[model samples]
Target chain A: MTDSSQVYVREVGPRDGLQHEQTWLDTADKLNWIEQLGEAGLTYIEITSFVSPSWIPALADADEVARTLKKSPGVTYAALVPNRKGLERALLANIDEVAIFLSASETHNQKNINADTESALARLSRVAEEARQSGKAVRGYLSMAFGCPYEGKVEVDEVERLAERLFEMGVTELSLGDTIGIAGPKQIEAVISRLGRMIPLERLALHPHNTYGTGLANIYAAFQLGIRRFDGSTGGIGGCPYARGASGNVATEDLVYLMQTLGAKTGNDLVRLTSSAQWIEKRLGRPLPSSQLQLSKEEGRCL
Target chain B: MTDSSQVYVREVGPRDGLQHEQTWLDTADKLNWIEQLGEAGLTYIEITSFVSPSWIPALADADEVARTLKKSPGVTYAALVPNRKGLERALLANIDEVAIFLSASETHNQKNINADTESALARLSRVAEEARQSGKAVRGYLSMAFGCPYEGKVEVDEVERLAERLFEMGVTELSLGDTIGIAGPKQIEAVISRLGRMIPLERLALHPHNTYGTGLANIYAAFQLGIRRFDGSTGGIGGCPYARGASGNVATEDLVYLMQTLGAKTGNDLVRLTSSAQWIEKRLGRPLPSSQLQLSKEEGRCL
Candidate 1:
């Protein structure tokens, strides 16, 4: 087993965060933020999503964002691809990895993607095969794996079934998302315990939102259960699509601060990350929802 | 060992929270909120502090608050008393329990109370004896037990020694406070492991601030280590007196939501507690910092 002392942090601000913003960030600005994230020693940066712009207008320049960003040699630049068409676009943009997402609940999957759970899985299976053949890494996101705002209390068996299928489809990693941020410590432990038995812990990642303020608690629980990789937005800019007016992804600064404080080797610089978060928040003309960023900005110090 | 499935929550919003607010809540309103908290099934509430108005003008009406609030049969109402004078005031107000506080670090103690650590301990020792003789349950708070804002990392041995001293001084419970909220999982585990050897876990409680957003994480860590009791503010209205521009104590709504989600029987109604939080926030004219309150208000649903 890999030691829990090291954590892999994946930054998903550009795709998950900006997509929820009402004001559109220019492609150049998105690329600038991506470059800043890479410079801060983030090994994985989900640059943008190649989904239809009609579905998420804020990320209309996804192709431009993926093509224009400066990629660090050590950083893996990723993009979210909703379908085979999006996968083709990601390949054209020279993305290092493509993430495909489907919610575990039938209602959530239908509401989010306009497809049922089985249809979404079949579609993702084909996309994963195509991406693998292109020599690109594939990541599967099981959104609402913990609970769904629409359905509520997704079962662990459902998550295991979906995750096993994704793994079989050649996904290098499976990101279990608490899409609405309703998961607590015991719920996280139960889900991870069941999933860990069927999937390798190294290939399992946690993607928790902070809507109900249980994000860090759930993350800590998962870490104790041997989950090492985590996905976070730089400034908690994203939103839970199902739970309107709730928070976005857990803040990258908060996650990095917690991991680093616990002696977990993240290889990310807290000061530099905070600076980047401040820079982006300034551009957005609104404060990010990150508690650590707010504290660092107010105190003029970093973790 | 006690079952980890049960959690005892201590609500300190009236004392810890209101004292930090710039706008004062009327004594009647404070009593109303306390009544609501008790109605929601909270068994313990720290009603008010017996500090002088010169120090914390917000709680100047503490006597009225403690005397006017309706004490439920099953609920234990507590008060914070800094010295023998404060302890006398608490007894005069008919408080069931009196809490005495001193920081684990000399600098924090000096800054917060105008006394060195040893002198503050000596003063608290006297107050603890008086309160115990009065047949009042006494709780000792060691502030900055996890880390200090000025001194930085506080040694665990220092915390253990202070906790041992407090226990020996007739304190029924010793609340270890992460006053600055800089503690992480490993640090919490290390401190709790060392403290658990000398003090019974039942006599130990966690009082963590959310300054760096690690409050819930620390609470979960302590809970896993068999520390069942936790202290929280209703609306996250309290501030770390030492850590400038930081968040207050972990929100009671957030903590209750987490414990309930984990199947820990707190016996508190989250909906009723959130209603009280909303009522207080409305009076303050600004939103409280509790993320759970925000979600509950936005979603119009409580855990």
Candidate 2:
């Protein structure tokens, strides 16, 4: 089992969460939110994505957001770069790390990036090389690692094959995405047990969605299997466009609460994290799906 | 670990869930819902409570609901009884089982039942005796077993003591409730490990809320510790009136989904359960907090 004392959480709310929102937040608001998340003790925050503005008008001002935000000391700011073009913009913005993503399922890869798996890997490899040449770290995201929407059940062998390819392309860490939120603890165990043989457990992170309310259970199972890193949104924002009716990423506040109760230190302040989530909830003009945020509001507690 | 092959789920939606709803459902609708639950493969359902109508107007027609609903063979119908008076009403209705409850925390007990732990236990012991004499099984619920809102951090020793007292009073089973939804996996492990020593694991159950999003994780932890019985509400209805900001009990649909995914047979039909939840959600004129229900609705699938 992994050491239960310390855990690393990467906040992907600003980028992944806001991308799916119909209401576009102002660039300044995004920067302020990112700064507040850092102040709340998040060591790593994915501020925005470098995809084409035409594709995601919500995060169109990513360059401005990355370049103008006040970067907190001791915090690593990252951004999602889809290709070499996105990587060049990330390099200009001096992002601390660049995240590239593809899908384990062939159908999902075709639908998500409009390219097959091999073609998408070829593009991400070029981006990884260029980002590394600029002395920046590269993180890979393997979507549908557990299940896919178009496809029924994704094979463990397919996930391992794609993960190994990403690692071979110099990707330092891979965050396995349960894009459809269809996984449970047993599925997590089955997949992680297979992957752990060929990949270092420490280099793996879990990105689970709470669509069917099994997100935290899956995380707990992975933790038991010695997986440490996790990714979550501040207010449980973000849903895959392809996965119909899917909830956002597992809420970061909820994840931190579980980790802390499990005796794992996440270096996050619960009160401040709740405050950040509430602040963003107001900005979004709609309630975010964080259970802790809802409870705090119901209790009328400042936290 | 408990036999991971089979699990017993007790549905508390009609009783605990409706008692907290602001809008009163018609007695006919309640009967219809209860029948549907049985048809959906729930073998144990808490149909109503025998408390005074003034205390819970939503369940004012408890006798009518209990007496008029069609009882399925092999399905046990239960109701919550506060004292000898309530048990008298329950016995008149010919309910199959009677459940009595108190709190692990002193303040919560006073606020919830208008009696301290000692007085509440004295009253419930009499209720249990009368119910058993009338040929009805008795189930005890210990609320705030994890933490209390009025008094934070309830002692596990206190839970053990109260549980032992109830078992001594001839309670065949005791369901430990996380009334405020403040527990995580570690707290579950801690509490169950202690309670398991003094009590038979099979006679213990977990009734968790989803307020802080740790409900399923807590259930998973308890299941790992050999807990086979769980209490849930269909569509995740019922929040604590005393515990401010607390969400409803863990959703039955979500629970069954988790158990099935973990290779445990719940004997509940997912499609029928989702339909029941959706039907109630419509009658309630609001969405229930079930993740699986939400996902099914989002997908626009019949299930």
Candidate 3:
């Protein structure tokens, strides 16, 4: 039987998904969504990114969004930071944690960050050192961990090396991201099974994309492999122009629905999640990518 | 390691999918789709039904469709028969096997066949007997086995009893049809595992709807329970018109993509599946529910 307690879902739509939206999220609106997510029992919400405004205009107000969040007692609010500069900005916002992301694929790394995979790793080491000195928790994200959109299939060893280097650099946890939504169940299990042997289960969180409609399947695969933490979007609103029509992330309501149905304790209120998902989908004036929210609405399944 | 070679994909789009279409497929169009499916290496294709044309005008030319099949050497062509009259029609047709469907829920059975579940099972008994005595293999279809659109969440005992009765009625195999798409992975596993203990692995097939977007997830859950056979439509069409659609059958292209990516041998070409799906979709003037087919076509995937 699958254990019910091991899955921990994190809503990353505000940081990962919203960062891709063309419309600028007002500071109050961003705070309202963050608070709503926290009240909906989302323990971890990636609040915003501390990246340069020129790179991600939607999140240019990351500091204000971070500062204005009505925090829950145990909720962890994480901020995405590219390097020491971004890290310094995030620390000033007094966020709960900071996440460092780098592309594992050489092509994506060069095109995305103007650095090869190794050079990105070297930068992460310096960032991790600064975070350690500041007494702040550093989390690492290995983008394109399962496969690369540009390069097709990725070597498992390449991902393992990146994970090992991040761990060696003193990052507390690693979130393996299928940036292009291409990881199927077998691939998710293959990567987790291989990585589980190298890193402790507690140190791994899975971030999957819904490009091939296997996002939840991949999450379940990781759950079966003893990984607990995962990442999702609220309405699945974020689309990466860079990823080229690829979906941003799995929908939060959909993820929670699958988990709750599978007997996993996410402590998430399905009704509020639906509202939050619907609220944002309305904000975007588009249909949400979440099957649960949409189906629940149709079936009148509200709390 | 899971032996991908053991998986058998049964293409049922022509019979199960097209039977309920509002826009009746032209005789030539059905033949062309079947031929393309055969050339794509699909070993089992449910060509058409021998049911009364008065009831289902969409499949009015079922007899001719069966007679004009390409007849690949090892391929299996099965026809659906609703009663003794339908079975008699199939017995005369040059078809290989006969299929009979019964609803697992009383309300669904009543709505579908104008009889309750018991009466439907009783009728299926005579249909199975007639097909058996004629030296043709009898396959039982247990519709609404998972969840009924009319009566929500069917009892497992109710389904098991019906399935057991059908098996005892000279029916060698059972295809569990989720009439509505409300069933999830856990529900699929719970029933499949309970039934698997009593029924042989090779004797089971799963039919799921994309209503809650659990079609692919249900496929994996069944796969975990050792079920290799599944029913799907080419573009994922047909639904309970009375129920106002809980989506329809899972898309054949999506199913093929899932099975192939999970290392299961379907022998069906993804490229060809997309082309055939697209061709019919254009003719129908409505989008087929095959996500991968749409994605692949938009991205210029070709055989």
lDDT of 3 at B111: 73
The candidate with the higher lDDT, 2 or 3, is: 2
Runs in model 3 with CA error above 4 Å?
A1-6, A22-28, A239-248, A297-303, B1-4, B19-24, B49-64, B67-73, B91-93, B149-151, B239-247, B297-303
Each candidate's chain A: what TM-score?
0.95, 0.95, 0.93
lDDT of 2 by residue, B1-303 (tens): 555678999999999888978778999999999999999999999999999999989999999998888999999999999988888889989999999998999988788778888998899889999999999999999998999988899999999999999998999999999987889898999999999997988999999988888889889889888898999999888865433434588999999999988889899998999899999989988656788777775733210
Better of 2 and 3 by TM-score: 2
Off by over 4 Å in 1: A1-4, A240-245, A299-303, B1-4, B240-246, B299-303
Among all candidates shown, the one with the greatest DockQ: 2
What does candidate 1's lDDT look like per residue over A238-301, in tens digits?
8643333456789899999999877799999888888888888888886567777767656343
Every model's TM-score: 0.95, 0.95, 0.89
At residue A283, give the lDDT of candidate 1. 87
**Highest-lDDT candidate:** 2
Clashing pairs in 1: A238-A248, B238-B248
True contacts kept of each: 0.45, 0.48, 0.14
lDDT against the true structure, per candidate, is: 0.85, 0.88, 0.79
lDDT of 1 by residue, B1-303 (tens): 567788889999999888867787888888898999999889999998999988889899988888877889999999999988888888998999999888899888887889987888888889988888999989988888888878898988889888888888999898988876788878989998998888888999999888777888888888888888999988887864343435778989888888887678898888888888889889977666788676765634311
